[model samples]
Each structure stands twice: as C-alpha cells, then as structure tokens.
Target chain A: MSDSTQVAATPAAPAEVPVAVRRAAAKPVSFGQVVGRSPFVPYLFLLPGLALFVVFFAWPAVEAVEASFTDYSIVNPLHVVGFANYTELFHDEVFLAALGHSLIVMVGLLPFSVAIPLWLAILVNRKLRGIQVFRAVYFLPVITSMITVAVAWNYVFADKGVLNWLVATLGLSDAPIHFLLDPHWALASVILVEGWKGIGTYMMIYLAGLQAIPGDLYEAAEIDGAGAWQRFTRVTLPLMRPFMAVALAIEMVNALQVFTSVYVLTQGGPNDHTTTAGYFVWSQAFQHYRFGYASAAGVVVWAILIALALVNHRLTNGKQANTP
Target chain B: MSERQVLRRRRGARWTVRRIGVYLLLAAIAVVFVWPFLFLLATAFKAPTQDVYSFPPSLIPRPPVLTWLHNAWTQIPFPRYLLNSLLYVLGGVPLFVLISAMTAYPLATASFRGSKVMFFAILSTMFVPAELMLIPRFLVANQLGLTNTYAGVILPGVLSAFGVFLLRQAFAAVPAELGEAARLDGCGEWRVFWTVMLPVVRPTLAISAIFGFIFIWNDFLWPLVVLNDDTKYPIALGIAYLTGISGTDTRTLSAGTLLSLVPIVVFFLLLQRQILEGAKGAVKG
Candidate 1:
C-alpha cells in the first residue's frame, strides 16, 4: 500500500521525481505493514488441515479423472482405453439399468426424506407438551449406523421373520413372503429403510426453515380469518419455497449416491433389480477390473446430478428472477 | 354457551378426535417401522430349534434366553470382531474430527491465492459418488502397501470433504476481531485457533465427531474391500459374514445378525439426544 510513496520520497531520487516525493519514498516497509497488524498464527493453525485436503480430496480427484481415460479395469487392470470405454458404456445394458434405478431412487426419496419430514416438523411445531420427546425419538434411527440398521432390517424382513410372522397370523399370505432378498420386494425394502433413517434429519432441517419464518405471518393469517389450510398454502409454503429447494437438492444427491444400504441389504441382487449407479460403478471397477467402463459410469452419474442441480436451481429461482 | 364458545368447544372436540386419528396412524406406521427390529431382537433370544417367526409379532420372546447369543459368540470370534470395530472407530473418528476441523478453519477464513477455487473444488468433490473413487483409492493403497492396514480405511476418511465443509461453516463464524486480539496478545496462530476459535466451534466438532463415529463404525464397503484379514474384521463385516452366505438358515442368520447390532443400538440409545441435537443444530445453523 505504501510502496509508491516510499519509491517517490528518496532524497537522492535520480530525476525520476521531485525532491518532495523522493523524501516520501525513503521510509522502510515493516513486516506488520505488509501483513497488517493482525496475527499470522491462524494461517499456521490451518496448515495441517490444508495438507490433509491435498492428500485426500485433491489427490484422489486428480488420480480418478486420469484413471477414467485409461483401461483401469481391475480384472484386466488399467490401460489406455481412450474413448472406447465411454463408447461401450452407452450400449451396456447393466450400466443403463443401474442408471435407471438411481434415478428412480432419487425421484422416490423426495417425499419420504423431505416432504413427510416437513409435515412432521410442522405437526410438532405446535405449542404442545412432550413434543420435544417425540423429536428425539423420531431422530433415533438417523444417528444409528446404516450398516447396523440395514442388517437389523434384513432379519426383520426374513422369509420366516417377524413381518412374515405377522402377515401369516393375519392370513395375509399363504406362506412367508420375502422382503430384502426378494426380487419384487428388495427395492421397496430399501426405500422404507431410507425413509425411516432420513425423515428425522430433514425434519430438523425443515424445522430450521420453519423457525426462520416470522410467527406474525401466521398470527396475521389468523387475524384475516384464514383457516389452517389457507395459512399453510399462502404463508408457510410460499415462505418455505427456498428451503424446499435446498432440502430437495440435499436429499436427492444423498439418495442417488446411496451405497451402504444397498450394499448391506441386497448387493444389487435379485437379478440386479436394486443395483444403483454406485454399486454398478463399484462392481465394474473393482470386482470386474474394468476401470475405464466404471469411470464412464461415474461420469454419467456426475452428469445426471449436475443436470438435476441446475434444473432445481432454475425452477426454484425462476419466480424470484421473473419478479425482478 | 355463546356461539363462539360453543363453536370452539365443538371444534376442540373435533380436533381431539382428529388428533387421535393422526396419533393412531402414526402409531400403526411406527409399529410397521419398528417391527423388523423387534423381530431381530426376538430371533436373537430364540433357541436354534425354535421357529423364528413371531405369532402376532411378539416383540418379546416367550422364553428369552442367551442361547443364540452364546452360539454366535462361540461360532464366531465375536469379541475379537467387536474389538476390531471399536479400535477402528477409536482411531478413525478422532482422526477425522481433528483433520476435518483443521482443514475447515483455514479454508473458511483464509485469503490465500486460489481460495475460492479451492473451496469450490472441495465442494464439487462431494458431488462425486464415493464409489467412483474406490478403485483409484484401492490402487493408491496397493501402491503404498496400505491395503488391509488401518491406514487404508483411515486415510480416506481423515480428510473428509463433508467434515471439512461442515466444520468450516462453524469456524467461519469466528469473528476476525477476536482472532486479531489473540494475535496481538502473542498467542500465535496456533494459540489463537486453539484458545479462541476452537472453543466457539466445539458444537460443530461434537457434531462432526458423532457423524464420524457413525460413518467409521458402520462402514461396510471400504472395510469389505480393503481389510482382508479375519483378524482385522470389524463388527459390520462380521455381521455381513453371518447373513451373506447363500442358502443360510433364517433362524441362525437372524439370530447372529441381531446379536451384532446390540452394541451399536446400545450406543445409539445412550447418545441419541446429543446426536440429534447436534445434527439439528448443524444443518439449521
């Protein structure tokens, strides 16, 4: 900041400027002057974290993109496949199936993860007694490990397990029907588990969004003789639009990338009906040793996610943008 | 009664009925939801010869016993697997917490060159499916001779993008003035963070730690892929081992799986409040 003045103020300035400016130039620059009066120690505090990001995230990404172009298949191992893998992936039936499953999962998870949870948050948002206890109880599965949750559910859904036991006594079916391992029931089983575990988390998020809205809006709605439905549609839903967009985006991304649940529950089995893009990618790359094809699949998943994100941004922001 | 009073009274009664209806709906749903867990628990306590199905879905076993738990213990190295899981979680969670916090602080506050781009790069990494990185990660691990070691499982998590993103949101809230004062007081950069900013984001740290514990403890795929030794098997892997075999008995498999989840469930019950509070505060914050 002071560099120009110091250069101009030199007493023996060689006709570059007048003596008055030259004198201003002679003052020395101190470390404090350069870095400001604040501590340089925070940067020191951040050094380790910065190094870790480099090792884990940055390094891994660089390697992954590079690996994509090659014949990085695990079975045959990595080679330079160029665009062959990408071209081949377009026609690959299993890859397409997995991609379709991922989309279905993302599209389906919204109501369970976001909508129902939002409803739950609103229900408990009342000034009722013991509601806080319900909040904790509902959120129990959210904190539990997915592996344990999935495994536990597997037993519960066994051919002769509790669910079947319940169904049999009711005479709902002739015999025990499969849940987790069944071709027909596997994906549905996954969805139920996903919803149970996720609803509580997004409920909290919706609560935050709800709390941010002014209480007076609802009070004013009441003053205007609006009923509960009217208040919700006019005041609550409109105000919550932005949060809905965010919550949807968050849950969509999470559901699309689901692995542990699918992995532990079915491993994309029952004729690969439940196989998601993530499992497909894992199998193609690691199990089958086809890294190039797997990388192509990864690129496809990335494309879908980015497209959905952009579309969501546009839909959410379009009205606001039009208003301005 | 006045008309308004009569209306409110009638409405209140109607509201009570509707609420009861809602409550019943929720209760029935909760029953369907929680039954699987109940089934597993009963299946765990049932004897081998006993039919695993619960008539009327008995949450309680008529003869609650430790026979299945005992069989599972003897059949597998149950204690050893539990120890391995505990060991991995112990090392993994703290390591992830510390590393993520460290990375998050600077990225949140720094004015270094390429800072915005750096932050975006990290955020974009979250968009990529984790499975996409598995082969490359395994390759790197194989090259480093880290496969089957704690290093393989631990390193990928230690510098988690999500953890960094989560913590940075908190750390960024530390006022610049407070940091300046600490610096002027000769605390150094380390002390300013440790003494001033660190305390402010303890909730975030706690939140991240809870998630880190869950993720590290429950990790199935990476552990399945990397850790090759039976001796190194974590509980999740052990549980998978029980039910994953083809044509397995519904009884023994269910029994073994339920026993495996007992520890994590117990942990969840103990920490449920803290974890929920932490998670709610975090995304909301």
Candidate 2:
C-alpha cells in the first residue's frame, strides 16, 4: 500500500515518459482542465471549512472586539462603556500584577524553551544505541494533559515531598517551603511546572534544527583545529538562530496564555500572586461574570502577542540579513 | 609495546571513560523526565498504611493495593468521562481530517480567484490564540444555543490552521498525472479526491489523525467552558473535577490522574516514530 501510494504521490518518473510527452507535459495545466472547468468547484470543496471558520473564528473574533467596548455580562444588559474597560484595566492593580507576572513567566521560561532544550538536544543528537528512548522519555510530558501533569506534580510540591526532601538534604533551608501556599513562591513554582512540561517540545524543536545542520561543517571546523566548544560557539550557535527564533516565538505565546497550570496548581492563589494575564481573563469573565472587562483584557493580551510576534519576525529576518 | 601503540591504548581508555560519563549523564536526565510518572504510578498503588509523603520519598509501594483505583473508578463518573473522551476523538478526528483535506485540496491544486486570500485568511487563524477566543466564543455558542451540547465542544476545534497547512503540503506533493489519469477515466473531481488523492496521501491523513486524537482527547479549556454538566466531561476535565472534589485524597487523585493518562501515553508510545518525525516535518514546513 505504501509503495503504491509513494509511486502515486511522487512526481511522474522521468524515465517512464517519452520525450514528446514530457515536452508537452512541461506546459502547465490550467486549473479549469483539472476540475471540470467550473470556477465554483473549488468553492464547493471549501464550503464546510470556510463556514466553520466564519461561525467559530470570524464571528467570535468580531464579537470579542465589539464586546470589549461595552459593559456586557450575562446578568446585566449590554451598555456601551467606550474605553472604560480598557481604562479600568490600566488602573486595576490585579490586572497590572497579572500582566507583570506573565512577563516574568515569559522571561523565566527562556532557559527552559531555548538554552536548556538546545543543550539537551545537542546531548541527545548522537549515534549511540537507545538514544531514541531518551528522546521519547523527554517528550513524555508534552503528550500528557496539563491537568495530569499538575496532579503528578502535587506530590512533588507537597510539604514532605521529594523537592522539599532534596532541598533540606542539600541544606538549602531549615523549614520546608510551601511552594503553592506561599505568595512569594507560588508564581515561581507555577513557572517551574510550566517550564518543565514545555522543555520536551522545545528540545524536540532544537533536535530537529540540530539534525538539519550539516555534519561536514563540524568536520571542517575540527580540521581547522577548532575545539568542540569553539565549534559549537562558532558553527552551531549561528546556524541555530533560526530555530531559537521559532522556539522563542512559541514560548512567548505559551507564556502569555498560561492558564491551565495556574488553574490546576495555584488557582491564582495565596493573594493572587500567581495570577497571569490568561488567568485574569478567565477569572473576570467566568468567575466574576465581567465579560466586557475580561474581553478588554483579552484584547490587550492579543495586541501584545501580535506585537511580540511582529518584533520577533523583524529581529530574526534582520539578523539573517546581517549574518550572511 | 611500541610508544605509538601505548599512546593509542591510553586514548581508547579515555574515550571509554568519556562514553561512560555521557551515558551516566543521560540516565540522570532520563530519570528526571520519567520520575514524576513513576511516582504517580507508585502513589496510585500505594498501600493504605504507607505514608504517601515522606522526607525521603519512598517510591516502592510495599504490597501495593488496588483500593485507590477502585475508589477512583466508583467515586466519580470515570467511565462516563472515558466514554465521552472516546466519543470526542471518534467524532472530532475524522471530521477534522476530512475538513482539512477538503479545504486543502482546492487550495493546493486549483488556481482559482481569491485562492491566496482564502489561504492567508485561514492561516491567520493561527495567530488568534485560544485563550483570547474563550469569552467571545462562549458568547457565540450561547447565542447559537450550542452550550452544553457535544457539538459545542467538538465543532469549534475541528477546524485548525495546522491541519489545513499540513494537508496542503501533502496534497501538493502528489503527482498531477495521477489526477489527470483518473480524469481521463471519466472520474469526477470528487471521485478523484476521495479515491485517488486521499489514498495517495494516507500517511499524511494518519499524521493528522494522530495529532487530532491527542488534541481532542486532552482538550480541557474549551470543554470546561462549553459544558456545565459533569457527565459530559472528557477525561482531562474529569480528572480536574476529581481533584476538586477529592481535595486531599492524594491516593485517589493520583489513581484517577494516572488512569486519565493511560490512553494518551499508550497512543503516543505506539506512534512515537511517526509523531517525532511529524513534529520535525511540521516545523520545517
């Protein structure tokens, strides 16, 4: 089955075609000839998907924007509040703290999403036996649900858990740290779990990038009497910039929208220290029934994410030009 | 021995030592990655008399029991959640793949008017983060009276840019000659798409299905928002609900969480090769 599919999927083998036929085939076929000459055929095929996209995405997106400008809620009738929701968001201490916490999470996640994963990818990008096993093991967390991960981590963050035991054994602190309960440590603990769960995905991305790098470049570097560290610094790091950009882009989006872990682990707890932008949106809308306020907050996050994505694109493309 | 031979022997010994060190380092990291699941496993089966939390975490549940597993099964609607998750994957993945293929086929093969515009419009959905969509999507669903329905949970998620993008690449890779040959046989475009094109791109379809299965199975937030009924919860949400009610019953919670993980982990393990390769292909594309 696969062989037949491969044959069909591949372009017409050059050897099988006569010179005349090949020459004739060189002329591009018109789209009309391919599907009965009716322009509506393609539209028919696209109808279901497009319909869903409009109903689910386009409609909702417009509603989100429109709802943001008004004081909308399930209980109260909709009223146009102009920029009140946005203005209130700026002044609201909780929302500002939530945004600040999201920023910290994004920065804290850099090592997990970029540096640590790159190192792990390099370590595992070897020809040794059973290396695939290591890759699969690392990727385990990526496949599991965040809820399950949070539940598993609860045991680790418990008062008499493995983490506390390790810290005490290492003489880091006298008393056990209340990782989820303490306001000071709650956000950091949430970040740790989020980062830990994400390391696998970023590691795989780096591994893909690493595998794409030509081996002969390293061989050439070795021939030039460059040591391993120098080879990595000079050849590997530069080639890896594109992959790093991809990782950072994904990490930023993920960090900004970190609700599941916060929900499962801390619930913005111990005085809302762990509340993030994503959590704030959920809490305002669902928990407190402030749909308009939440929509406004969501729009701000959406704007920031788009801006970050644009800046990342500019930086990566700009650096690519400068390097070569 | 000659001096050169002695030098070679010394170098071989150093290489062996380095190999051992690398292996040891890898094993340690592997443990760090796998330890949590192992702990969950141990805790789920832990005897009632054994302390779940200890200073030096004892992982080996001495004379492990099935009491917590029983509790996890009977205390909540575990079977109902499992069945709902199964139904979701069954209802969602096929439709997801089919819609992606249908959408991608025209975009990939035909050069119709507004094709590029349509493609970008679909691709632009990738930027609209799910978190940001929650409130208004809920409002839309509420307006449509889809809230608390199975369709509400499954419909919004079936269409994704990633699936369309991946399937577009797959459809584009197929030789045009095959379609031409089928057309010569008086096959309509629909027949060509269903029989000729789809079978040829079966592997890509499989890849899409695997990803869809994992996604729909583990979808938490959308279902949580859409469905207020506990009986309709998927396994992931079910586990969260379990955690909420079980509170400090760590053993039962661990058991429930472990059970929730079984289907996904097993699916992943079985298709790890395809999934890992597909992950790379996804990024490169």
Q: Count the backbone clashes (under 3 Å) in each candidate.
A: 22, 0
lDDT of 1 by residue, B179-221 (tens): 5544444443444456667778888888788778877777777
Note the DockQ of each predicted structure.
0.29, 0.47
**CA error at residue A79 for candidate 1, angstroms:** 3.5
Worst 10 residues of 2 chain B by lDDT: B182-191
Residue B153 of model 2 has an lDDT of: 95
Task: Give the candidate number with the greatest TM-score.
Answer: 2
> Which tens-of-lDDT digit does each residue in B1-285 have in candidate 2?
999999999999999999999999999999988888888999999998999989789999998999999999988989999999999999999999999999999898877788898897797677675766887888789999999999999999999888998889888888877876665554556666777889998888888888899889988999998999888999888888898899989999999998988899889999998887776656663
- Model 1: lDDT equals 0.71
Model 1 per-residue lDDT at A47:
62
DockQ of 1: 0.29
